[model samples]
Target: MKTLHDLHRPLGATGLMVSPLGLGTVKLGRDQGVKYPSGFTIPDDRDAANLLALAQELGINLIDTAPAYGHSEERLGKLLRGQRDNWIIVSKVGEEFESGQSRHDFSPQHTRFSVERSLKLLGTDCIDLVLVHSDGQDVEILKDTGVYETLDALKREGAIRAFGLSGKTVEGGLLALDKGDCAMVTYNLNEQSERQVIDHAATLGKAILIKKALASGHVCLDSGVDPVQASFELVFGHPGVASAIIGTINPLHLSHNVRVAVSVIQSRR
Candidate 1:
């Protein structure tokens, strides 16, 4: 099997190269209201550092986190300090989690504040990519909020490299691609409703990142099939997909996932 070091590709028109599998940090920080099938203990700072180190050693260069993902940004800031150039950090604004519930804020004031807060929490001068964390009301948020415009201004100010939306609906994803640099959508074996978003991203020369590619660990695989291998086959087969974000705190699982991703990509050749 190939390694993540050999599986790099461009992330659409963003001019950023990323591995086919991006390490997601949801599990690294948040556990209160996640959708994982089984309960998991959150890893401490040492474990987190080890996992991140293993990710880099395996050649995974993209790290996805969000303000809503508990203290993920803060943890990553501390863990990855002095090595920011080695990875592309993707984060989001407009969604805040507190007391185990999520809230949306798309106002220009909130957007600006969120970006600034992310910079502080991540201890970075500029965020690589920032996405609007949409509530289910995707179109309404795009139409009514100044969040996208705020992100555009931030990009001009050199605070963010690229911006997009982590949309929940097809219309929202399409609109995000129309106005931004990328779209993060959920696409897995059991649920392919967002395939159109991927197709559109490809056509528009924009980026698309896959979330919940393993169905949030709820996928019911066939007895003989490997879930990780099958999931990568479906996700990486799509030319539009730049990377599939897999959130696992376990180093063993991360290693397995990267290996499976490499095998899938190699098989395509």
Candidate 2:
């Protein structure tokens, strides 16, 4: 069986190599206002540590987290500890979750503050990637705010390696790729509306990190079809997809996901 590390590839032209299966860390922090099909308790430190260890063992290097994910950043800081160099940490700015509510602020000031805070929280000097957490109005945020520009500045200053938008719309994804190194889009069996964005990224050598690739575990596959295998096949079938961020907290699910992802990727090759 191939480990995820065997499937690592360039993140567009960003110069950072990431696993085909990046682990999403939403369940490590906040639990409110999420759209998961079922509820899950936030894992304790020991459990979280075991999960990370399993991810590392499976050769997963890319990790996804954001300020909107509640205490995720801080928890990762503690859990990751001395193993920072073993993983590629991807955090985000613009969206903030607090008091059981979520809000957005894409101003340049907020963008800078968020990156700096993430650095402090994660106990790292430079983040591998940081993205703009768009609030539905992807095009407006990209054009109206100085957020992308601020991220560029931060990148040049060595606070972040690369930056882009975790966008909501096809237009926004295209625009983000036009100005940045990557764009996180929602693509899965249920959603192919962003295929244009993926094609565009492929043409431009920009990274496309897939969100909701399994439809947040709400997938309705045909009877007798294996949902995990089917989802991985659909996602990895795309030549432009750099990675799929699966946010599974269950260890068995994580291992199964990696195995399925490896099989799908290998079959494609």
Put down candidate 2 lDDT per residue, 63-87, tens digits, no spaces: 9999999999999998998999999
Per-residue lDDT value at 179 in model 1 = 92
Give the per-residue lDDT digits (tens) of candidate 1, residues 1-269: 34789779998898999988899999878999998899999899999999999999999999999999998999999999999999999999999999999988999999999999999999999999999998878888878888889999999999999999998899999999999999999999899998999999999999999999999898887799998888888998899999999999988888899888887898898
Q: What is the C-alpha RMSD of each candidate to the true structure, in Å?
A: 0.9, 0.8
Name the TM-score of candidate 2: 0.98
Which one is best on lDDT?
Answer: 2
Query: Each candidate's lDDT (Cα)?
Result: 0.92, 0.93
Q: What lDDT does candidate 1 reach at residue 43?
A: 90
Q: Give Cα distance to truth, residue 215, candidate 1, Å.
A: 0.5
TM-score, per-candidate, Cα-based: 0.98, 0.98
Pairs in clash, predicted candidate 1: none
